[model samples]
Target chain A: MFTGLSAFPLTPIDEKGIDKRAFVGLVTRLADAGVDSIGALGSTGGYAYLSREQRAWAARTAVEAAGTTPVIVGIGALRTRDVLNLAADAQSAGAAAVLLAPMTYQPLTDDEVFGLYEAVTAEISVPLVVYDNPGTTHVTFSDELHGRIAVLPKIGSIKIPGIAVEEAPGRIAVLRAVIPAHVTIGVSGDWLAAGGLLGGADAWYSVLAGLFPETVLAITRAAQTGSSAAAVAASDRLEPLWALFQRYGSLRVVSAAAESLGLVNSPNLPLPLLGLDHAARRELEAALVVLGLN
Target chain B: MFTGLSAFPLTPIDEKGIDKRAFVGLVTRLADAGVDSIGALGSTGGYAYLSREQRAWAARTAVEAAGTTPVIVGIGALRTRDVLNLAADAQSAGAAAVLLAPMTYQPLTDDEVFGLYEAVTAEISVPLVVYDNPGTTHVTFSDELHGRIAVLPKIGSIKIPGIAVEEAPGRIAVLRAVIPAHVTIGVSGDWLAAGGLLGGADAWYSVLAGLFPETVLAITRAAQTGSSAAAVAASDRLEPLWALFQRYGSLRVVSAAAESLGLVNSPNLPLPLLGLDHAARRELEAALVVLGLN
Candidate 1:
């Protein structure tokens, strides 16, 4: 079952490939900070850029480091068979769940998208989280499709994109109406965490949580405890850091933030995704200092 | 020295993995049909979907099948080091050239893009083709960047998106002026091939050429011979097939067309990219008959 702040850490790659020591360090930090789960190979993990072998290695490393904590591995790819292959690997490596994103080169029809998840779910006994990150995957899920996939066997959760903070409550309510109560509804996109939690999202699938796990968990706890003002105050302070995420991607901002806080060895965002520019790094440092993260 | 109708073929994969027999069959067919060059592992080849090992295997198969015909292998990836590694494999496989597309998950700046090519060209002895496929790579080469990259040593050619048939001549002329005389300027997007040839593009980097080489060569030859009327007539007859390419992607339409003609086992558009729909297949059949390719 997926709940609470699940930390999605960046997979650090040095010259030797998938720096196991750096990865173990980050995952152990999050586990020790008391996050509910560790989501490895998420977009922040650079799943798309890595070779299948590298990804599997990263997953194993994260799971081993996570100890008693559940590890949810992102298992998205272009092919149904490949996704199935990854899911099998994830299940074998002791992952609690495999996240599916229906990532395709061309636009997929709803039926085709459903077929992908159906194929993967049938193969893996582990629970599935339908990751609806349309921004990267380019495959948007309709409410009808959501309701359809929600009832599939071993489907534990659905990580929906963050709605506007103002619309988070209504959006959560609408999804809850159709999706079965058993399916945990988590919110992604770090900026919308407090609003989504306040609006009754069961979990926050977080990027910042990888580095600042206790801080993120604190915010989630405040929202869950019905401390509205406390949650609002916490979310308000994170706005500046979130601005860096909006300017550059969350992947870039988070990598820089982690390095600034001495969580990761280097601010090396894997290739294609460059590290933050000098000015942006300065801005991130200021935000981190103000938030008492650095 | 890339020139004439260079065929870009799809890599066939089945349950057993990269269908080596099928790939060899397709590449041999293209070589027998007298294509000027073989562009193995290009976009239509589904470069992104394949593993490094599979890609190297495909390149080797294509080169051996191509025989004397120049084989250009696509060596694009998210990381500069990965591209370099692929380029080394392509070189070892006896490929005549390696095509580099600055394909990145994150948007790359002009400097970062240049740095990638510079890093690649420094390592390999073979010429590199700067692939500017904005549709997939999400990285566009400015005219300025194009002119800048043209002068790099061993940078033999640039595969540009095809312009409209009517605008081909002018576009080719403009590029030819900035790009050196020796660097071959090839036009991709098969629908724009005839016009690109007529407009004086050095070669047609064609998808249809993979399946129907002589037919495409005939059109290119006609244009080369200054028979504009003949080239136009040939392109006009294939408009219906071009319509399918415009509606779907060239990868899908070309794969469908190739399969319908019995050139390969099936029009198996790789995963993430589905095969043609029933209605589109019907429409393709009709077009093939009219063009005498069925």
Candidate 2:
């Protein structure tokens, strides 16, 4: 099930808490778009910024709104205990799988990271995706570590960060050689999604697909069908938006795009992470207009 | 009040939550040693792995145990709202000041980081200490950014990570030039505490001080009194222990030492953060005995 496009939607949270209405709309929209799966509460979902109650509600809500589309709920938290609790909540809420990242405050050791996966995988009933997002979690998984953890029960997928285009095949090959055959590889970082998918990644765990499902799905379908040129061309068409994502981070830039597109209320992000400034917002809007996304 | 030896004790916790008796004992020991201040809930205190309620209880317990000793509670959380709430709880619990690190899961921007300080400073009743431990927090503050935050009201201190012995003076000088005069600088990284203090830092935020206050206070005093050789000699005496800290992080090593000393129960750390392995613990015990710290 961890194949093709896994759209990661923003939770649309603010000072009051999860923007349930906007969130349901985002999820329902993804379900309608026929993406392979919905990854609610991933990095783009801002799981780290939310409370467990809020996150559980998000998991249930995303599952409900996604209809028949499989919803993979991200249950990453600073504590192993909280992650277990969240996994139970996600499973109870009828999630297809639970995405777990080794989130840290006091930088975790390799053994500690392994212990996290070991402890969680032991209790969780659902298939667990290993979220190797170093950009946010700061816990990088060496392939040796990945190999060790992959043999654990219920380990379904491995979500790797985007590798440079030229390095994607070799990186994916190295990772693939370690994990079990059934454990699919999902690539994140929307700008590099096309190359990663073409380079033999089984799925694209995407930020852009959350808001612009059809847009990224075009690239995904093209890549999956072996039309690499079309996939690259489709991705190239949104170069301007990707540039903005690169400059200001996909979360902030996507929030700006969502706000500008009037899909959600202004200041949609959680605090300390304000929406982009006026100049950056203008740049984002200009990019959207250039890409005909607006 | 922010100057001198600031001891950050481990918040002896396991699955059952904060060991109130052991925690109070640690706090009382620091107070009895006449350390300059008690930094409750700092990284060594495992504030990140704890719930806000647990942290509030820790703040109150530490304050009660410390008697007249001022307690600075760490109030870092992933969200600004949570950070604000933690700060309020800390202040209500009678914390002398709130220590905050830009604890990120989604890497924050310069503007967002500055905005975090701006929003937090405006709300907290207690003075705020900027915790700059990139080793734990993963958020590195620029001198320009430090200068920007220092100008804000209620900014009391900056806790910098340790530097190389030779580079300490130049590094401190560069940092001192950027921030305001009144905001004191406290140096962390126990092994480098002597160098940092001798380099003209106002305080030593020593992890060792949390467990063995007298051991570190001797070094701090010698450095503060301009006895450079004495301070270096005192630090040098603990070279074996420092080497262990360098090999396996200070937190794990210190926890092992604390448990070995019968100060806390074994496996005192939060889940996912296992105690040092048998070999590492043996190494730590050997080092402690060598330094006569056991």
Candidate 3:
């Protein structure tokens, strides 16, 4: 019965380390915007870059800001032990669920993939979501693979990126046909929000929710109430920002947007990823202003 | 100065976990092939797929088999702390140097990349090799960035993959000109051996060395002695297997070749990576036989 918009808030960091006050403020704003859930340590949150201590702090801040709302902690890492450690830390932070992606470096076998989930789920008491974002990680959870993973005892949901946006509905249908009714299917693309809703996605995962929470919430509300016209209108208004996300990729665009919104001090990405170019930054800033967010 | 051929030996896993006997045997065979050094836990050795305990055991086995020769341990991971821990373990296991790939997963900034190396080198006592393999890790070390990292204490070498074969000479030249003369540059990819040597690479990071150590040693010795005819003869003999490595990709081709030579019991890969198809297996087997390796 998970529905509506979920915000993936950026984990703020400065030279000294995790900026807890800034993180708490961002989460408070997200919750005030009517976000149904907050997903911390997601790619937009720079989960891969943060130290274990930073991840725990971000998860705690999200839960504290959420008050009664659920918090889903991202536990994606190359090592299963690290994932399990994060999962346990999330539980200690009172997160309602854990969102996990498979090991990023080595392409795992189907059995090893299953074992990864099984091992992680075995360590934590919280509900688990099999987060499938193959573009960043270079690994995909096929519909067949999803079917097999769905049967795990605590696997309550899936956060699938619409890599093939057009075929998302068919993919959703295939997943829905396999998973039990209790397990919710969530789509992770802004463009596919309308289609994901019409195709029976229970909720939408929005990176935009970090900077434009109210707008994302409004869209989800309209979609849930079956107000197709209102939903389309919201989607149209947000399409420009989504286009920006598509341009430089979500992780970079979302981080930049978060910085503009004053949710975080700087878009400090870890090693290997450069900051946005001047043109991309100006483009993002213009989009934010257009959306009345900057 | 580092020279000759290095073998990245596969870690053996059985029902009881890491098969020490199998691993020891594999390393012993590589030693018999007269490999200059033994590399443990690399992509070909399934390093990322291993648990920390398994990795430690593999390192220990490699050290034991290596005897007087050096054992280079792969210490790359998603988390900085884990990499540090692995480096410490590797040093204790008597590994002569640690091969560190910059943080995997998300793209990183140059500062953060430098921070990772600085942190590893600060705590670990052994020499470190900066491994730049963008194909697997999705990150590359630019010459400018390499120049910055090279200044760090204990950073004694670099291992650059030969996919960018043409670019090897320029990179090696830059490193040789900038870094200390003692810091050797090792080249990966069998086909790039001649080019790499001509480009001033000091050593061959040879996967083929796992199967044909003598061949690799002969080629390197010939190249060092300025015997072009002998070097070409060796390269021609091993060219088919190297071509197969390029076609099927290094990890798959190496594992398939090892299985064909009865070095590894199974051609099993961890989750997400499908094993070689029958046609690929046949081609690999034929290539190995052609090279007189099987």
Candidate 4:
């Protein structure tokens, strides 16, 4: 039911734990920026580091702050039962929909992959978005597999990452051609929004929108209204931020950007992933200035 | 404290849930074959396909049938918490040791990989084996990371797969040289046992042992007891089974052999992975006949 720019806010964490105030503030800011929807516990939100209980709390907080805006909660886990559990929690917390990724470590055969989605979708009462980010999750769904899974009942949309910028349009075309008219396709990058929209993606799942939400919203509105010049202008201004986001190549980069914007106190990532290095921070600062986001 | 040939038996499943009676029978048969230990719910044992509750039941059943012989429970999972929980269940069920692989799916940084193992090992009270099967897990423990994790208390062994045959000796040497004396380096493969043992591996984890445990046990015992002639003879006799197992490049072939021997009925695998094809089944039967197991 949601459209336009959907901002996936960076989860704020400090030495004590998840900074609830900062997270709530972030949700409020994105809502004011005209974000069509907000997503929590996504890759940008560092869902892998959060406990199930923490994820549930974050989902609730985001949904409450989002008010009338649709809140899509990412429900990714390695096991089918865990994913189902998260979906139930998200549904209980009043999330509008749940974004699901395939099992991360164990590569499932096409049949197994379809079966996993079927199992998860069957358990949840909420609308589902089948997230395809094979770069992080080693397993990828083929076009045929995606086509089969799209026909399932509860699936509402497909979220495809924009890293494969050139391939994304074709991928989106394949998905659009197969999935019914009711199903929407969302792009997960800023730089490819113009091309993605042209290729049939219904909306943008914007990470940069967390920092400059209005700019992305304007671009999405312009693109949807068939104003090519307005969409290009907006995309041009956001390109620097998009490049910076790509430089770090990890989820922590989004949090680092949040810290740079003073939206969060620290870029303190959970153990295992080190915070952004000095060079990366400087690059981010330069890009922020270029995009007028600093 | 146990060593030599260890067989990870396939979990039997007929139309009626888990075929516990057939599983117990298979264990009893392996015990009679002079197998030194039993590995349960491991990759070969279809741990990924079984539900968590089913996994616990299988572990318990295997432990009950194992008696005094050591039972090494496989505790691999995508999240550290799940692995820890599995380890606790395994310890409570009386498993002798726990074997775990690193987080798969997302390409983990070296630090994340090490952190995952440390988190699981810290919580486990019993001895644990770090099972490094990069082929399936898509993540490898570098020699440096292995050395760091090997120092942890209760860390007892390393299971290096045979695909890295050439590197096995060097890796074993590094682990042996750096880790405490109590930490054993073991190799998993039918043909690499002799070289691995010669290169200082303390034991072997063999799939062939499920079908021809006597032959594998004899070879390992002969090698351990300094009977080169006996070891060579035993290895020669087990060659056909090894060749058959390698043909399909999957562990299901081993399960098919178990079915051929009447150890378990119906080698019906879970969704995604089909059972042995016609040619593979015939080859397994032929190999079993040649190995005198028929």
Cα lDDT for residue B221, candidate 3: 83
Docking class of 1: acceptable
Q: What is the lDDT of residue A13 in candidate 4?
A: 67
User: Pick by TM-score: which candidate is best?
Assistant: 2
- Model 4: per-residue lDDT, tens digit, B1-294? 636778877776643467888878877767777777888887777676566688899889888887777889998766565677788899989999988887554466676777877887778888888888876777767778888888887888888777354566686776678778778777787676765665567888877676567767777888888886677677767677667656664466776877776767784455444467788789878877876778
- Candidate 4 matches the true fold with a TM-score of 0.79
Score chain B of candidate 4 by TM-score: 0.92
Clashing residue pairs in all predictions, respectively, total 0, 0, 15, 0
Q: RMSD of model 1, in Å?
A: 2.6
- lDDT digits (tens) for residues A59-143 of candidate 2: 9999999999999999988888888889999999999999999998878899999999999999988899999999887887899
CA lDDT of A249 in candidate 3? Answer: 72
Per-residue CA lDDT of model 2 for B212-243, tens digit only, reads 99999998889989999999999999998899
DockQ values per model: 0.35, 0.87, 0.27, 0.26
Question: Residue B83 in model 3: shift from native, Å?
Answer: 6.7
Off by over 4 Å in 2: none
Tell how far residue A142 is off in model 3, in angstroms. 3.0
List of chain B TM-scores, one per candidate: 0.96, 0.98, 0.93, 0.92
TM-score each candidate.
Answer: 0.92, 0.99, 0.75, 0.79
lDDT of 4 by residue, A38-154 (tens): 988777787875778889999999999988888999988765666878999999999999998875443555766787788888888889998888766766777788889988988
